[model samples]
Target: MAGEVGKPNGSGGLGFKGSQIPHIKFTKLFINGEFVDAVRGRTFETIDPRTGEVIAMIAEGDKEDVDLAVKAAREAFDHGRWPRMSGYERSRILMKFADLIDENIEELAALDTVDAGKLFSWGKTVDIPHGAALLRYYAGAADKIHGEVLKMSGEYQGITLLEPIGVVGAIIPWNFPTNILFMKLAPALAAGCTIIIKPAEQTPLSALFYANLAKQAGIPDGVVNVITGYGPTAGAAICSHMDIDSVSFTGSTEVGRLVMQAAAASNLKTVSLELGGKSPIIIFNDADVDKAAELALLGVVHNKGEICVASSRVFVQEGIYEELEKKLVEKAKAWTVGDPFDPTTNHGPQVDKKQFEKILSYIEHGKVEGATLLTGGKPVGTKGYYIQPTIFADVKDDMTIARDEIFGPVMALMKFKTVEEAIQRANSTRYGLAAGIVTKDLNIANTVSRSIRAGIIWINCYFAFDSDCPYGGYKGSGFGRDLGLDALHKYLQVKSVVTPIYNSPWL
Candidate 1:
C-alpha cells in the first residue's frame, strides 16, 4: 500500500476539531482491472464526516464510464477464461483473496472509519473480519454447487445445470461499504459472474482499495470494476445500462425504488434490493436486566445507529419498564464517542453534516411530540458532527420517531402489557428487517421468533451475525438475501438439457 494509515484499538476516545485533513487524491476509476481517469475528467471531494474536512478528491464517474465498465464486464463474462475454470480453481483463488483481506484488515478498517465515521472497533472487529469471512464462506461454497440427472419416460437422458448470470451491477450503501460489498461481490465472483460496483459517494475509498486488491489477486481485468460518483449519475447509469445482467443494491428504500424503476426502463434486469428498516427490540420482564440493557443499547446506539436493520424502537414490558429505562439511560450516557482513529471510542460522529442535522431534527421532533426525553437530546461536541446518544420514553407507536426509520442513535421506548400486544406493536411497522427478543423462557423465544415478520430474529441477543447465515428482510425493508449460499444462487441461472439415449424403441 502506498498510503500508511493508523487504526484505532480500544483505548482513548475519538475526538474531533474543525481542520482540514490533507486531501488524498484519487482521480481514477477502476475499470477492466486498470485505473483510468473518468471520460469527462470530473472529480469531487470526499469529506471526513467527523471533522467536516475534505480528506480525498475522488473521480466523478457518469454514464460514459458506466458504459465502459459494463462493456468490459460483458466481454469478460461472454468470452473470458474465468467462467471456464473449474469450480475448485475458482474456490482456491477466492480463498487466497480472503487471506489477502485478512493481511490488510487494519489498513482497510482505518480507511473505512476515516471515510465513513464508523467506529474503529466496528470496522476492525465486526466489519473487516466479517467481510473477509464472507469471501471465505462463498469460496467454500464454490464447488458445492450441485447438478442433478433426471429420469425420463422417453429413451433420453436429462440433466440440469447452474450457470452464471452475465454481468452484474453491485450498488452498495455508505454505512458499511466494505462489508456489504463483499457480501455481494464474493458470491457473484464465486458463481462466475463479472461485476461493476458503484459504491456510495460518501465512502468509496475502501471499495476502491478492494478493487485494487482484486487485481493483485489475479482476478482478470474487467472481472471486477468499481466506479465512484453520485447515485443519480453513476448509480442510475449502472442500473439502467442494457449490458448489465442484474443489479444488487443496499441502501434506503427510496433509492431502492428508483433503482427498480431504472431497471424497468432499460433491461428489465434481475434486481435484489436490501433497503431500510424500522426494526424493533422487545424486553420482557423475565429477562436478565443488565444483559438486556447492554444488548438493547447496542441494538440502536452502537455504530451511531447507522445500520439499515438498526432496532430503533424498544418495547419494554410494563413490569420492568422503569427499571430497564433507568439502566438503559445510565449505560447509554457512558458510551465513549469521538474520533474513529481513537482505540477507546465506542461511537463516532454521524457520516456527515446532513446526517448529523437529520439526527438532531429527529431528536427535536421527539421532544415536540411529547415523548419524555430521558437523556441526551443534543450534539455532544463542537468540532465534529457529534450527537449525544438519545432515548425517548413514554413513546407511543403513533409517534413519528417510532413509526419512521431514523437512522441515528435515538431509541424510542414504549410499554407493552402482554405478549400479544408486544407482537402486535412490533409487527406494526412498514419495515421488517430484523427484531430482537430478550427473555429466558424458551416458549416465548419460539413464539416471538415465529410471530415477528422480520427475516432475522435474535433470541436473548441483538445484532448477532454470521457469514454462513442468510440475512435480509420482508415488506418495505426490501427483498433478497445477501449472505450464505443463497446469495451465490442469486448470481446463477438454471438450465435443463435433454438428449436421446440410444434411439431404440421410440424411433
Candidate 2:
C-alpha cells in the first residue's frame, strides 16, 4: 500500500480500501503560529508501519528547535492576547477548533492510519472524534474556572486564584496518537496556557495536521506549537528548558523519570506523567468464563496490545482457570491481524520496527521463563511489523512477560486459588496504572476493587475510559492525572490573596 501521495496505487503512497491517500501537508515545525523549517536544516523520515516504508520527511527539531518553540510559547503566555483573554472568548475559539477537527476528521484519521498503523475505522469512530469531544468538554469548562473565598481566624480575609501555569510542554505517545494528543493538549489550552507539543516521532503525521487546523481555527500565534522530532533530542529539550513552567508526559516509565530529573535539575518545573503499566484482569470462578475470556482477550489484543493500560496479566480462579484459558487460546488464534484500512482487520501492526522487535524479544523471554505457549506467538505475513495475537498459560508473577510492559499483542494467563491470592499477585508488579475485576458476586467485586493498589479499577469489563473520570497511576506507572478537572489543574497554579478584614494595611 505504498505509493505517491496524490497518485493512486503508485510509488510512495499508501492506499486504503482502494482509495487514494490523503494529501500530506504541514511537515515543518510549527512555531509562533507558522510552519517553518528547523534551524539546522535537518529532516527525518516518518515510516508507514503498515508497510515499513517512508511515508514523509518531517522537520527534525532538536535542542535549537525546542528553544524556538519554548521562546514562542513563553512570549505568548507573558504578553499575548491568549492568556489575557476572557475564558468565554477562549472557549469560543476552542469550539471552533473542535468544529474544524470534525470537518477534517477523515484526513486526520487517514494520516494516523498509515503513519501509526492505527485502525482506520477506530480512528474515525472513536479516536479522532474523542479528541473533538475532549476539546468541547474543556471548552465548556473554560468559563467555569473559579476559586473559593476563604475564612480567616485573625480578622483577615483570604482567597485563592486559579491561574494558568505558563508555557506547558506536552510529550505524547504513539499508540493512540489522536486520542492522547488531545488528552494532554485540550486542558492546557482551556486553562489559558500556551503550549509546545513534542509528539512521538513514530506518529508525527497527525500532529502536524492538527497544527494546521489550530491556525485555521483562529488560535492566537505562538499559543500552540508542535515540534516533530526524536525523544532524546526534542523531548529532552522540552523537559529541561528553563522557560517551560510545567510538563505533562505520557509514555514509558523510564522516560518519565528522565523528564522529572530534567525538570528538577533545570528550574524545578512542575511535572505530570501517565506512564507504563502491567495491568491485571482478575476473573474469578463466579464470573462467566466465556465472557471473561473475551474481555481479557480484547483488553490486551486491542491496538495490537500497544496500550499503556493493556491488561496483559490475566489471573483466573482455579475453578474456571482451565475453561477461561481454553477460550482465550481459541479466540486469540482466530483474531484478525492485517492492514489498518481493511474493514475486517481488528488489529494492525506495531507502531514501528523497534517496537516489533521488542515485543518479539519479550515473547522469547516468556518461553525462557518456562510459561506454556498456549497459542499464536510469532510474526505474521512477510513484510511490515505484524505479529500474531500471542497467549501463554501457567504464567507466574515473576516471569519476564508478566513483569515487563511488552506493549504488544501478548497475554500472560495465570491461575489463582483464592481471592487473597488474586489480590496479592495483582499487586506484585511495580506498575499500578489500571486493573480489572470480573465477578458475578458484588461482594467479590467490591472487595477486590478496594484491595487493588492501582489508580483505576474496572468491574466486569476492561478499557472502560471516559473524559470526566480522572486517570493516573499510583506507583511506578507515574504520577498526576489526565482527563477530568484534575487534568486542567496540571496546567494551572494557585495564588492566595490575603488581607485584613476590618481595614486593609494599605487602606
Task: Say which candidate scores most in TM-score.
Answer: 2
lDDT of 2 by residue, 311-403 (tens): 999998899888888898889988999998887999999999999999999999999989999888899998999999999987888889989
Residue 430 miss distance in model 2 (angstroms): 0.6
lDDT of 2 at 392: 91
For model 2, give the 10-residue run with minimal summed lDDT: 1-10
How close is each model in CA RMSD to the real structure?
4.4, 3.6
TM-scores of the models, in the given order? Answer: 0.94, 0.96
Per-residue error for 379 in candidate 1, Å, reads: 0.8
**What does the lDDT come to for candidate 1?**
0.85
- Over the stretch 266-300, how does candidate 1's per-residue lDDT look in tens digits? 98999998999998899999999999899989989
